[model samples]
Structures are given as structure tokens and as C-alpha cells.
Target: MSGMDPSAVPGPTVVDRRRLVFGVLPAAALLAAGCGRSNDDRSDGGRSARPPLALVYNGPQGCPACPETVAALLRGAPRPYRVEYVGGETPLTAAALADARLYVQPGGGADLKGTWRHLEGSAGAIRNWVREGGGFLGLCFGAYLAGRNPGFDLLPGDTNGYIDSPGATVTDGRDTVVPVNWQGRPRHMYFQDGPAFFLDPGADATVLATYPNKTAAVVVAPYGKGRVGVSGPHPEADASWYADKDLSNPDGVHFDLAYELIEATAGRR
Candidate 1:
């Protein structure tokens, strides 16, 4: 909140879906039968299968850089990790969520209105899945979706009062760099139109990072047996992103931040 500037950047509007592209295939095929049952039902004693990380990639409503984001996540993860890409006609079913350990919603649409409108069918399934023990990581638009909304409602009361605080896409969509105090260090993160979550009286989330304004840039909480986390900026941005914007990050700090996010939310599984 403090270091963030209200400067206008250039990019697609929150509802703009014209430039959408679907380029990546799922890293692993989703098993239809093992929906929400025991995750370790395939080993010697019918041990549960290793849980894979599920990522939402709705083309039209998804961020253009989502593929790169996923790639970075995969690179940062330990070997033998399994990741899956959902959406783009692939349904996010209850069985799929139950079989997995974590679910990720990348940044895209400005508001949950359009996101929920299209993926409304998976809403209940996701909520139930997380409540049952699945982990969740939401970035940018994904963060807003977790808040008080008709969508997934994974974080219902958490966003009660700050409905309007940077909820929509920044006035300008241009890529820019902003300073964020993550954990404790001042790190640079890619900024677009991202939210600064305002927790309500009964909100259950814990603020992890914030802009200079003290606006929440990252927050995490437990939902039933699972965990839910959200970020208002793109820590997943790679070197190409910085190059494109003429920004410099020789230390690859953003990737470290991204790796930490995965470890914090999905790594446990």
C-alpha cells in the first residue's frame, strides 16, 4: 500500500478477453474414477496416489502470462512433482479436486463477476474440496475470487468491508514494477491491477505481505482441514517479463518469491 503508485499502466482490461490464448497442455491427465476418494489407494495397501497440483487456465478469462507463470512454478518445485492444467473446456470436477492436493487460480479477470459466471459449475465443487483438505493458491484476480463473492466463497467474510480497495484492474494495464515487503524484506514484484485485501471483523486470513500503503499483498488462512492463500501481484513473473518492461532483476528475486509461495501453500502436500 505504501510504495504502490496510482500510476496508469497499459494492458488488457479486466473483462477484455479478445487476446486470450490457450497454449499449454495439462502436465498430467486427470483420473476420472479417483475423484475425491483416498489419495493413497494405488500403492501396496491401496495407498493413495501422489497428489498433483491443479492449475486453472481459462483461456478467455485467464491472464496472458498464465502459461509462463505455471512454467515458473514447475521449475521452482522439487522433482517428481505433478502439475495439471484445467479449464479451457476441461471441467474442474469434485473428483479431480479431491484427488489433488492443491488448486491454483492465476491472475486474469478483474472481478469475480466474469470468472464465476463462466466457471460457476465448479464453484461448489471447489469449496467442498478445499473444506475437505485441499490446499488453494490464488494470485491477483484469483485473490479477489477467494474474497467475499458469489464465486467460490473460499474466504467469505475475509473481504467484507474492503470491497472497493483496488478490487478492479488498475486503471492502466501496462506492466510495471512495485516494491512489496514480503515476509520482511523489501522485494520488487510485478504489478498490474491487483487488490489490497481488507479483512472483515470475522475474517480468518493472515496478512503475509503488503505494499508501502500497508495494503495486503499476500494472505493465508486455513479452511477446514486445508489451507488457502492469495497474492495481489505476480511473483511468478520470469526474467522475460522484466526484460519486456525494461526492468532489471539480475538476482531473480521474483522467482524466489514464487517458489516460496508454492512451498507455503502447495509444497506441504
Candidate 2:
């Protein structure tokens, strides 16, 4: 949030209240509690007594409710963790990153350029933080931002629309579900304008899931001392999201994939 222009920031919305109701406390509270100031402030050598923090990027760039959706998923993670929204008033900073173990970028609208405009200012801080052993998780549009072309450049290569990839089923950006081989098991997950990764030759990347076309749909890769896990679809999406689009996941609303990605990114897996 530091490098962003104050005037460009969007004010708090009703969704902010929704986030609070979902138990995702604000990042400011943690920062105020000496979570980021210094290692001496914490009894566990910089680790706060509070649950580990997972910072979700909530801003104009992300789709409405997507950040809250991701926060809700984190709340239900197998491990105890606290969720916080970062953007607008609480700009992402080095101190904020210090207290957080994982950072997430959720889905957004089709405005890739606009999304980049809002997040480009904090790119350096995010990159540096991940290089210093912080975790990063990108979902949908967030996955696009993790690539080399108009992104955080956290991935070894770039990403492209899944619709454009070979053997793709969904050719349009409509609210729908697509088939994927998740860890060798066939499953259907929500999809919109998700991306497919094109890793550079010799890049050490793990493919957790693959699109029907066999392209990487969910991937995990190392970035310096840290790690990055990304998904092309919305594994964190809930029943309400499907209800809005008159869609449903045959496998039901499961957060296992999301939780696994979080753990992997956080180096817990």
C-alpha cells in the first residue's frame, strides 16, 4: 500500500464488513500488535502469539467477493491461521510482509491492464518478500499475475488463456466447470478465464493438476528461498458462487485442493 497513490485507492465497502464477519481480521491489528516491528517483540522470535497470518490482496483489481472467498477458505485450512486483507487503506509494505507467512492474489475481472496498474507499485515488495522465504498463492487472475508477461514474474515462464490451449473444453469466459485430472484423479472445478502455464525449459515445476488438454492447471514452483503455488480455477469458491451462476461442482464444495496449495506454498507440505 505504500507506493500506491492515495487518491487511486478504493474506499472500504460492505464486503469489508463481510470479511470481518468471516473472521478475517485486518492487517493493521497485527501490525499494531508489534508483529512486524522487530523479532524481539514476539515471544517466538518474530512469530506472534496470534495464529500465522495469510494476507489476501483485496483491492479494486480483484473481483468483488473473491478476496472474501479466499479468506473464508483460509479460515477453514487444516492448520490454524488468521486472514487479513491488504490493499487500499492498508497498502502492502515490507513490515506487513514480515508478519505474514503467505500472500494471496485472488481472481479479478477481465481488466488485466487495470489490475496491473493497481498492483504494480507493490511488485517489488512482494518479489523481495517471496525471495526472503515468504509464500505466494495466486488464484485465477492471480495466476496470470505470477507469470513473466505483465505479472510479478514469479513463475519460470508465462501463462495464457486456458481456452486457447490444446484439448481445452471451455472456449469462452462463462461461469462453468471444467474437467481436470487433479493428482491423477478426475475432477470438475469452477472455471472462468483461467490460465495455463507454459513453463520455461528446465524449469523445476510441479504439476498438481492438469487441464483436459494436459496443460498445467495447478502448479507449484520454488522462487528463491520461498515457494509459489497457483491455480487456474477457483478451488476456494463456495456454494454461493456456484448458485449465482446456476452451476455446481459434482464433487461438492471442497477446500482440500486449496488447503493443499496453501500448505505447499507455506512449506508445510
Compare the candidates by lDDT and give the number of the best one.
Answer: 2
Clash count, candidate 2: 2
> Tens digits of per-residue lDDT for model 2 on 1-269?
00112222211111111122244533331110000010111122344566688898877763445676677677656675677789767888888888888999876534555667788888999998998889999887788788754679999887887877777887654557888998989988877657888899999989899998789999999988899998888787666656655677989878788887788888321
Root-mean-square deviation of Cα positions for candidate 1 versus the true structure, in angstroms: 10.6
What are the runs in model 2 whose C-alpha is more than 4 Å off? 1-49, 267-269
Q: TM-score of the candidate numbered 1?
A: 0.71
- Measured by TM-score, the strongest candidate is 2
Q: Each candidate's TM vs. the true structure?
A: 0.71, 0.80
Report lDDT (CA) for all predictions.
Answer: 0.56, 0.70
**CA RMSD for every model?**
10.6, 11.1
Error of 2 at 145 (Å): 0.6
